[model samples]
Target chain A: MSLRLAVLGAGAVGGSVLDLAGDYGHDVVAFADSSSSAVDPAGLDPSAVHDRKEREGVVGDADPEAVFDADYDVLVEATPTTLGDAEPGFSHVERALGDDRHVVLANKGPVAERYADLRALEAESAGTVQFEAAVGGAIPVLSTISDLGAPHVTAARGVLNGTANFILSRMAAEGLDYEHVLAEAQDLGVAEADPTFDVDGIDAALKFVILANVLSDGKTEYALDDAEVEGIRNVPGTALDLAAEDGRTVRLIGEATADGVRVAPRLVPQGSALSVTGTQNIVQLETKHAGQLNISGRGAGGPETATAVLSDVSRLE
Target chain B: MSLRLAVLGAGAVGGSVLDLAGDYGHDVVAFADSSSSAVDPAGLDPSAVHDRKEREGVVGDADPEAVFDADYDVLVEATPTTLGDAEPGFSHVERALGDDRHVVLANKGPVAERYADLRALEAESAGTVQFEAAVGGAIPVLSTISDLGAPHVTAARGVLNGTANFILSRMAAEGLDYEHVLAEAQDLGVAEADPTFDVDGIDAALKFVILANVLSDGKTEYALDDAEVEGIRNVPGTALDLAAEDGRTVRLIGEATADGVRVAPRLVPQGSALSVTGTQNIVQLETKHAGQLNISGRGAGGPETATAVLSDVSRLE
Candidate 1:
């Protein structure tokens, strides 16, 4: 029952999945990242994995291409958010699938951007591409879709980005302006320094795109560029105040429909579970068959991502 | 890859799974119900499963003892709610697991009443039990617990019951009373003739017991008797009018902690997503590590249950 796992982009999620795979007694064969584009010969040091993070060109001095060279059955992709536009990242996914390697993506960029083509890539290779960690970190969003068959998923919606949620929660709680809270989030290592993807709702947009494509039937996929996204930059501290005045809470909501999708800030009432859900967490998804299905918890981070990746590994059977 | 599956009950979910399994070419050896206490040699016709519904004791008329005696590896328990304290219905689960059969329960009552003893019986036989459809119907709540790992789940909370929710939704929208709507639900065949389990919160209370046992961390055993139960009987129709006056929605909420559990009607803000989640649906599960995770979809009926059972068959690998 040992799966030969090859990790692409030896950053936070990739490293954590490798650790879990080792714990679960899976064989780790290859390791690569942007820092070291060539494959490692001596096998990955499980201990050294936690020391890296994905930046622009590298992660912990390892190149992304190196992780793909190992003779492995499955590839775990944890590249940075290229918004599915990065040539190298998309090529990496295609190459893994072309190699007949089972693909598991943690990055939202590829599937969100070119889901039709990547889905075709899966069929062309006759390989499975499981990416439960992509949409909502590890909230079981993707798996839930697989579980329910998504027939009743009339509308898919949620707080898909933890960084934006953190910003919104800070704005709601501390009565601070959006910029001030986002800066604090970056300094606290919650939001990225180049927070365009998270702040402008692009991150959540990418998630909705995939959710629309993967989790729904007869549902139109949304273009990330076309989504009506409003970042947390201008949300005044008084937003939460107004919500509080009306016994409501403010949350950045992402939604999908038959026609298109929308991701923006909305006012939710106080004492509502979604209103109470704060900081790096998300809640909301109403389905036709199963009623109002809620998936909340850590919207981002390594441990949840690791569980998601392991779930992909389990799907190899 | 086809797995031999024997359905223990020919009720709504069991019959649906059997039809799909037969269509998909899974080797279904026999059928079991109250009448067929023993497994019969000749397989039951999947096509004719529903023809006996009008017969007196539909389950018992199928040769219950004969069904259990048949050679089968996977046993699907899909009867209506029956406690371990009851006869005929619940004992089938214990006997099957005790005999080393891999059991998947869409039936809620057996697990609700005697989870620990059942788990112990499964342990003795070294059997795997899958019950994703038990707690939240098609919602994957159980799998969510498994995906997040046993460590990260602190409390199991959200909207678990659906029949009551439909009543609440009607009350909120049309300004109707609980009893009147209950009568309508029964006429619509959504609620049973005697709606104590569905309307009185006993159903959700039972589901809470099952979830708590799974997440209780070596507590090994728990009971529904320990739970503080509240049905929708106390919720006045005027409450919805008042909530409407204040822009709120009344929802039947179920919450379970390590110490105890409660299922009652609550007044959540009307515009809130929880309030908007209407009719035969379910809501979130806030995991300890993952935060407030939402999963909405159809909570009852044949399609969702059929999908769940078929998905279980797919997971036999």
Candidate 2:
């Protein structure tokens, strides 16, 4: 079955979703960004949309607000994350859910910060919310928990942040200090200019909160402040060297248990499943009967996140 | 929604299914073994069934053939795998699918040896077939592909066999030969008495065939003979030691590409995703857009496989 999609935020994720929509049997009916938007009652051609966006500054001539009322089956929110109170992204998701349209989120803020509100909206709305891309990029972590059902999941732990992990991995491998590795990561475009969101563990913590909510199916609501957070910024070079002596590696790990969410730099055995390397993510789910299940992959990338969004769209009945 | 199930096979897999059915919100109304069968339309108590099976040496007093005529929404096939023609398991699956009942397979023979027949049956039948347990037990590998839509999958590679992996991992860690480790694994109840299916690469090849068929959505029929198989029986410890000098590890890998399927021992980088140890299994999917996705878990165990079966049952909408 083909689904009509109104995509907000024409960034890498949203743009790739438009690019790959036809491949997954979905049609893009509308496209929106902060400044410009486009719409068609029928489906918009992905290639044509791409050309238009490239040739012009926007997707089309329509107003940004036009996407809110566009006739579509699913609304994809891929805007930049707004941590506290989750602004424009929050409003975008709320408006979409209010219209009884299924929402597929690539934005992490609204999910991690405003999960309860989204759940409330879903309770009265005809459409459901899917955010597989919100946590682990292409890793299908949330859907795995949902597929197995909530009650069966006992604990979820993983390397949820890519940039932080990249820095830590480089530090351990090259015996470099935190600042030197951070500079290298920044230069390589892996870490952001500020890098506080990632290096301070807030990004991983946010993803952990979202995972916790997903595992509980919204029964357990955890916010950013609820987690016991620690970053890799304080991890010294000597620590990695000392860990290596014991045949271990330092990974910035995010864990969500019944107790709550925790994100910190943890010493992991060198060859274990949790000892994943740079830019790679792993989610280890402890189940009541299924035993420990670990899923790892590219945690973040535009096309990779777009693939996750497309997977969610295809899964919608 | 609760599904009525008639399970065939009274081994660890089938028994664990009955034991864990109540926890997963399903009812086990009927169960069958080679010699005896049981029925409880109102839903049999898992503990009671366990006690009966222990005391009577059978599930119940009914004839084994009675299972074919029993009424149920879904059928769980956990019969032992038979190579080549895939006898009793194939026949059991055909009967269930013919009767318009959803089939959840824990058996490998039917899936590996009879993909084309099963696909035809699914097309003609009202009910669907789910076999997450057939590939990587409790890892949700098959369903992940199915959910992502098979067309997007470019290639799939993994550590599919647990017994072979366990023996190889033991050999590598202790610097012992295959025979010594195999004997230790046998004593530890990790390897089977004969271990032919595992050590000979047939088991891994069968799973690779099934996975290849799944990736093609059964459009491409691949059997055991289709794969270029090589057993780990001849892998010398000297080779592992040589690889370890360069920070590499030896693993028995199964790969399925558009070209064909292959099972053999390969050298993997020590800290790579494919370098999973012991009885763990890892499936790395290379997608057109999702990048490289990896899922790893316990590939064998009565309860782990049973949990996969239970997950399949709950997912049969």
Instruction: State each model's TM-score restricted to chain B.
Output: 0.89, 0.97
Local distance difference test, candidate 1: 0.71
Q: Which stretches of candidate 2 lie over 4 Å from their true place?
A: A45-56
Model 1 alpha-carbon drift over 4 Å, by segment? A37-43, A49-64, A216-222, A232-244, A273-277, B1-76, B90-104, B109-129, B149-209, B212-317
Q: Per-prediction interface RMSD?
A: 3.7, 1.0
Q: Compared with the true structure, what per-residue lDDT tens digits does model 1 show for residues A273-297?
A: 5664445455456654334556566
Q: What's model 2's lDDT at A152?
A: 93
Tens-place lDDT digits, model 2, residues B10-52: 8989999988888887888999888998998888888877898
Q: TM-score of model 1's chain A, to 2 decimals?
A: 0.90
Candidate 2: C-alpha lDDT: 0.89
User: lDDT for every model?
Assistant: 0.71, 0.89
Error of 2 at A74 (Å): 0.9
Q: How close is candidate 2 at the interface, in terms of C-alpha RMSD after superposing the true interface residues?
A: 1.0
Model 1: per-residue Cα lDDT over B1-317, one tens digit each: 66677787667777677666755456667666655532334555664555554454463344666656777878887877776563454677777777777888888776777777677777788667777778777667777776665555677776777888888888777888888888998999878898888888888888887887878754756667877889898899998898889877788887767677888888787645466455545555655434555555667776577666666665655
